[model samples]
Target: MTNPLFYAKILLFGEYGIIEDSQGLTLPYSFYKGALKFSSLDSEFEKKSNTHLTKYADYLLDLELPKGFELDVQKFQYEISEGLFFDSNIPQGYGVGSSGALVAAIFERYSITKYNPENISKDQLKNLKKVFGLMESYFHGRSSGIDPLICYMNLPILIENKESVDKVAIPESEEGKGAIFLIDSGMTGETGPMVQIFFEKMKTEGFRKTLKEEFIRYNNACIEAFLKKDMNPFFRNLKKLSNWAYEHFRPMIPESIFNVWKKGLDSNAYYLKLCGSGGGGYILGFTKDYEKAEKMLDGFHKEVIYRF
Candidate 1:
């Protein structure tokens, strides 16, 4: 039997804002992916993956999954003992959904009741997100399940709010100079710690007010403009969103990216924001001219995910 592939994901918008019932936009990033596979477990990497899977299997066995969603834990354990491992290139702690792809792959292969990703209903998608949240929490300590949900669906997901999520169609990439890209920070970030920082910041009434009034407003506007293919408003709101992150999400931003994040705001050549929880993973960038942004961001590893 052939194993299915699960792709990495990018939470393009609404990283911390989503927890506040704000809208979010996420898309599958096929550049990095993972799949379930059998290995001899000779290499340290393979052995490590197998060991993690063994522990994960134990967690799943004790997980109280939502009704109508079930994994064949016995089969999962048997496979783990048989040297089953996730073969993936998705960079861990990069905020590109590494563990998410692994979770999606496991659910794809071991779920006792499966819903077709191609034709799933809105309720099914919500249920799947709930189940994924429970499963992936074993890794992140706490999870919103959005990452695995995007990986499993392999589609752009628009989170209208906490209770509303559905597949969305994004404007297709064009050959124009404007682009959306990723910049590697040369360090790994822990989602748990970054999230703790966010929660801590949330305790401040001023932070909470700004997040709802300014941050979410810009984020939702960016999503709406991007979906409508309105470049002017998209970039306008994107700049605001980027600046908001720069001012409020400083702790989440790694030291290496601090200067460059400001440089974009000053130059108006590009804007940078957290790819996921920030701390040190990949930083998301937007530019009207990829060439200029490339020149300004020299020495940093960059990959363009979308071009306008």
Candidate 2:
């Protein structure tokens, strides 16, 4: 009955680079969340979701390989059989961690080991990412488990590298002038194909060079500057990261928002980045001046997340 909701997550920085051990900053977005509930799943969406969860439960049981992230899942099977399903509004395939939230909810409700503080360490986060990656891989072709971990912990997490993650405090919204917001694209994104495209692009020397030299540099620097609360460096690197994402990661961006994304970067009014794996869902925006950005985004609905 009383299942806590796991919110969606946004990978603020470090997208493809995170796989190569780049630094990442992730935050929970509560605007969309999922919670386990008992209800008559009569609607098509509800029935399909319930059925998918059943299959996922089976997938969890079927895993017998060596796993760094293991959990006692027998209890979860029992719950799954008893009408356990996540009633969520978070749209799947939008790259906003829809399946990740569900995976976290299941683990939080059923995982026997409580690795909160004493047992939880960076090693544990790695183990978790591995296990969660396997578990969530049932939903998507591949996963990093970072999204599920963010949803499970319900805390902002900073990825020092692929092997380490730690809880972080977000800077306070003191002045309320600058803001972070999301612009909805109203379309779902496919993860597997997009990832394939990225891999193909990586095979090209020029693209790979840009990814390593420019994208990684700006993305990693942004993480450091943001964490250090060095405003000037943070904004400076944000612009760079935003620009890089626009140029090289255009395929991942939604076609509808491409123009707005470019215009924002060009004008320096606001810079847009992929909220998740791009394709669609919500595009995250950062601007020193929200009113100006809002005016620029007049046609689309922009939801303010934070201000500083």
Could you list the CA RMSD of all candidates, in the order they appear? 0.8, 2.0
TM-score to native of every candidate shown:
0.99, 0.93
Lowest summed lDDT over 10 consecutive residues: which window, candidate 2?
64-73
Per-residue error at 147 for model 1, in Å?
0.6
What is candidate 1's lDDT per residue for 65-120, written digit by digit as tens?
Answer: 87688889999999888889999999999999999999899888889887889899
lDDT of each: 0.92, 0.81
Q: Model 2: clashing residue pairs?
A: none
Clashes of each: 0, 0
- Per-residue C-alpha lDDT of model 2 across residues 67-133, encoded as one tens digit per residue: 4345567877676566667889887877678989998887777666656633467777777777778
Runs of candidate 2 with Cα error greater than 4 angstroms are 65-72, 117-119
Best candidate, lDDT: 1
Off by over 4 Å in 1: none
Q: lDDT, candidate 2, residue 93? A: 76
